[model samples]
Target: MKRLFLVLALLSAGIGFYSCTPEPHFDNVPVITFESISKNTKLDGFGNKTDSLVIAVKFQDGDGDLGVSSTLKEDSLLYKTTYNYQVRTFRQVKGAPVEISQTISNSGNFPRLRDDNKIGPIEGTLSRAILIYPGTVPKNDTLSFKIKIMDRARNVSNEISTTQVVVNQ
Candidate 1:
């Protein structure tokens, strides 16, 4: 009987491939940090009169959104995902560019792990340091940076860096 019709066609193709397999989703991602940036070491820290730049960050979420990236180097700084999610942005490598303002979802009265050290009020969040007085920059140039985090069904986190600002000329 052709081996019982080949075992009933291999159990009807394994029950239609396990009933069209599909099911796997759990959103919860957001954690970022970079608590410092007031650089203006004598107008050579790469700047352009950035209205007093300042950037310091810290985030840990269960919904999604945090980001920063870099390539502005004169010394060293880089990181853009080993894994984690939602939104991340940060850039610099030649002249001017720094604008970070992000807050995505999460009003569950977060911050309960000993307040995770600090920086957590939850009102559009806050943590940054930046000061760009772009008037002088030249010395082994190579700058790059990135910091990102995301959740709220966007899930993304993993990108933290700071390096390549060795302009001690």
Candidate 2:
């Protein structure tokens, strides 16, 4: 009778452990949420002072193909202009809204989250610093950014916009 009781206890413990394991369910297409945006002052490569807007975003991908290798060459599959992360800047001068031109390159690439070739779900926060020069915007002006990310499979994530931030303050 003791042997049968021990066996049943072990079986119940095993079932409990198995049921506690949680599996993540996410869409293959990437999804992103705006986390935060902050401003800082820093020196540029040219020894000039500049302001930086650090934008943080949380992302989730089912396949985890969210970034490109630094050594990978641009091809038809991944065009030169296909940046993994894209940021569009907008400014409001005294509450008047205006969209910045595309002449400024606010897009860049993020390192791959998973080094292995195997695909799986991934979720993390990505923070990027965008430099703002003296004339980037007027003093005491408010700025905001619209952000999106793309996976290696050319899957574009949902777009998210950051809250307004005062620059040159």
**Model 2's lDDT to the true fold?**
0.85
Residue lDDT tens for model 2, 85-134: 98888998657757787557889878878888777888999999988787
Determine the C-alpha RMSD for candidate 1 after optimal superposition of all C-alphas: 16.0
State how far residue 99 of model 2 sits from its true place (Å). 1.3
- Give, for candidate 1, the lowest lDDT window spanning 10 residues: 104-113
Against the true structure, candidate 2 reaches a TM-score of 0.82
Q: Mark the 10 consecutive residues where model 2 has the least summed lDDT.
A: 70-79
